[model samples]
Target: MISKQYDTIIVGAGLVGLATAYQLLKRRPSERVLVLEKEASVATHQSGHNSGVIHSGIYYKPGSLKAKNCIQGYMELIRFADEYDIAYELCGKLIVAISEEEVPALNNIYNRGIENDLKGLKLLTKDEIHDYEPHAAGIAAIHVPQTGIVDYPGMANKLAELICQSGAEIAFSEAVLGINEATSTTNVETEKHSYSATHVVTCAGLQSDRVASLTDRGNDLRIIPFRGEYYQLKPDREHLVRNLIYPVPDPKFPFLGVHFTRMINGGVEAGPNAVLAFKREGYRFSNVNVNDMVDTFSWPGFWKVVGKYGKTGMGEIYRSLSKAAFTRALQKLMPEIQESDLVSGGAGVRAQACDRDGNLIDDFNIVRKGNVVHVRNAPSPAATSALSIGQYITDQLFVN
Candidate 1:
């Protein structure tokens, strides 16, 4: 097997991993870094498949890692984009409460946004909701001026370019097989090569838990894959959404419900209902892996999650099978939208972390054991918060 040595070895070449390498090279220009990706190129999964929304830290709770990284990374991302000439837009977004039942949750989100130090937040009345999104129906709304969209794939590619220019090596299609930690160096064995590094950071998204378990045996968390299915509006129907229109998310669930997003490139995207996936990277109902299913079913937390969210899970499955049900969910936000207005779009699988106690971790869970750091759970806003998360990881490696 080919053997190599580096100052740091980072697994997974997604946005976060690439950003980590970028940050590392920026800080210590002389340090040799190597990034390994299972995919042929960067941003093949979560980082590339997301809605591309630059979250304004409005939905996350104040003082949480998600909030801190998203807010800080938002600024850094804009700066990076500006410096790199990547295409992006600050079109803003609206979170609407379609009924009185959702009003309290909307109010709470507004308060959280304020506590998170977001500026230019406006709680709008029913009439004012039309002022931002003319076709959107709601009892109340919160206009988040900072939320926008960007080309994440493009950004990921740019980071890879910058990292390579700075002398870091990125090897594609190298799947990690094992990680062995010695007294001073960590040896990482991939499918084709064995390498050694002083420190290893695993940013493996869907396969994070499995990768982390290679070194840390007592990992208490299991990654439960949830496939978020989306639909794109017909070309003629894109006008229904001005920028982005969201629903007041269910506080019980980590997912923000089905909504509409105006893509930074073009067209409008609707949907992304959270449904349990049979495969870790499964993007469709027919995509199933027996091993992945076995891993999920074998976990005790999976059963508890199913027991608690059975009804919601069934609803999501129903929507996945029936397009009319999905349309109805979107109609709550835009009354004029019809079933025919939407065409099939893409899907992304979120790697959500679940503990033995049956809790779906809501924060960015980064665990450090010995000289290795594992990003156990980083879903939405991760792409937006890539730079800050990278900087944070860099700090962890150097400081503590």
Candidate 2:
């Protein structure tokens, strides 16, 4: 039996979900909204575990969803931060090419930035690179002055606060187990209670596929979990990285290569090697779930991905296991960085979506079935693109 009814019910209280709720209330203040989260507080997973970089829409392909949302969201985020007094900085960053082979890729990124209409993008020569980051070494680089860091968790929390202030309810520790879409309303069954809503939006992140499956069992996509591990520079060596120093990412893979970041809170963080995680939310190698592992191995796409990227996967696993290997990857950008200058940092799991044909979905995907909308894949720029994505989702929801 449904004990309560709301106009809309949102699953997951991460940045995207919270932003969705915020937008919904902002536009339709009279509509009843409820946000359901499985955790005690907001941003308990991917949203909190990120490196906190505010992407400048430089690396994404022109005309893609990631590029569109990121560029629009970048401006909206700055405006939101200023309005909310949330702490953030536009500290700028560099995408550096350590070898001559990387320059072509570097030029490609610059061209994409131009197509994306990103301003003040300066291409730097080997000598000019020092003008920005003195200790950094690169044959060529793109100085992206718009890239910076922010306190994402803080922003998420404030959104939640404003959501509640608007008379909406955010129920914590309520995990949605099933969904039944009827003629006019959908019944969402949770562990503790049953609720009904005219519409349901799920931004479940790690469990997005599972949540979507509750309504549409034949969904073709599956989320492949990849754990990104970080290492913070020792306090004494933090000065080596003035801002963000990134590598020319491997175009074939979605994971950005390990890099250095000057965090908004202070200090510096290096690395973030992406390796396959046995558990959906697993942070450590030893943190495994048999059920999650089975779900992963049972998928045909899993084996296909492994077969194609076996060599690159092995190298990332090697870096995850060996501190020396991780340091060497970072040393390509800053040669002075040694293993001793680093300390173990946090880890984040990315819910990368893969299809049965083994193609990794590279863009943000939002699909609507019946009255339910599922955010199937939202990674990296998702956080930075939260507000704009929220607006987009809101527009879709009320389009009729």
Candidate 3:
């Protein structure tokens, strides 16, 4: 029996889901909204596991959804943080091109930043690079003044509290197993109970494809989990990184290469190399799920990705296995950084979507069918773009 009917039912309690819920209630305070999370607490997955760097919208292509949302969301996020009294720092970040070969990509990123209407974006000379990061070594760099850091978990928890205060319900540990759409309403089935909703919005990160399939089975997109392994700098060595120091990423790869970020909670993080994960939630080499592995392996898109980027993929595996290899990548930016200065930190699994032809989606991908809307692909800048993405999704799904 359906226990109750909500005006809207949101799956996943990650930042995107929470932000969407908050926006929905802000627009319609009287609406009955229910947010269901499979985890015991909010922001338990991608939202909490991230590096906590507030993206600057510098890397995204102009006129893309990512660019528009990230630019607007960056401002919105700062406003929300100020209003809610969240601690954050606009400490800025440096995107360094260590070699001549990387200079072109760095220039392209700069051009994109200009096109995206970023203010105070400065191209730094080799000598100027050290002015921002005293020890950083690079042939060229871009100083993005808008980049910052914040406690996303703290922000998410606060948003959840506000959502609760708005009279919406957040049901923890309620894994939505199925969604059935009828003529009049959509029935969402969780492990313990079934509920109906006028509309359902799913921001399921790792399980996005599977959850979306429950509503629209014909979707060709699939989520391929890539585990990003990180290492924290020893307390004594934290001084090495003054702020966020990022390498000029390869255009071919969708993920930004391993770099350094100073966490809001203190300490520094380095080297989150993207390696294919056996399970959707796999955080370690040994944490494998047979079904998830088989599901990933069975996908033609997965094989296409492996076949095309086999060498790069193998390199990521090598970095994962060898701390020395990971350190060497970091050393390219900071020659003084040694493996001993690094200690094992946490890992975050990115739910990247791939098409049937094996093309990794480069931007946010969302799909809608009947009363159910699915956020199939949202990664990296997603945390930074949460509020804007929420507004967009809310407009698409709810706003007349």
Tally clashing residue pairs in candidate 3: 0
- TM-scores for every predicted model: 0.99, 0.99, 0.99
The deviation in Å at residue 131 for candidate 2 is 0.5
Q: Model 2: what TM-score?
A: 0.99
Which stretches of model 2 miss by more than 4 angstroms? none
Write model 2 residue lDDT over 167-262, tens digit each, in one string.
999999999999999999999999999999999999999999999999988989999999999999889999898999999998777688999989
For candidate 3, what is the TM-score? 0.99
**Whole-model alpha-carbon lDDT for candidate 2:** 0.93
Per-residue lDDT over 94-159 for candidate 1, one digit per residue giving the tens place of the 0 to 100 score: 999988999988899999999999999999999999999999999999999999899999999999
The global C-alpha lDDT for each of the candidates, from Candidate 1 onward, is: 0.93, 0.93, 0.94
Model 1, residue 220: distance off in Å is 0.6
By lDDT, rank the candidates, best first: 3, 1, 2
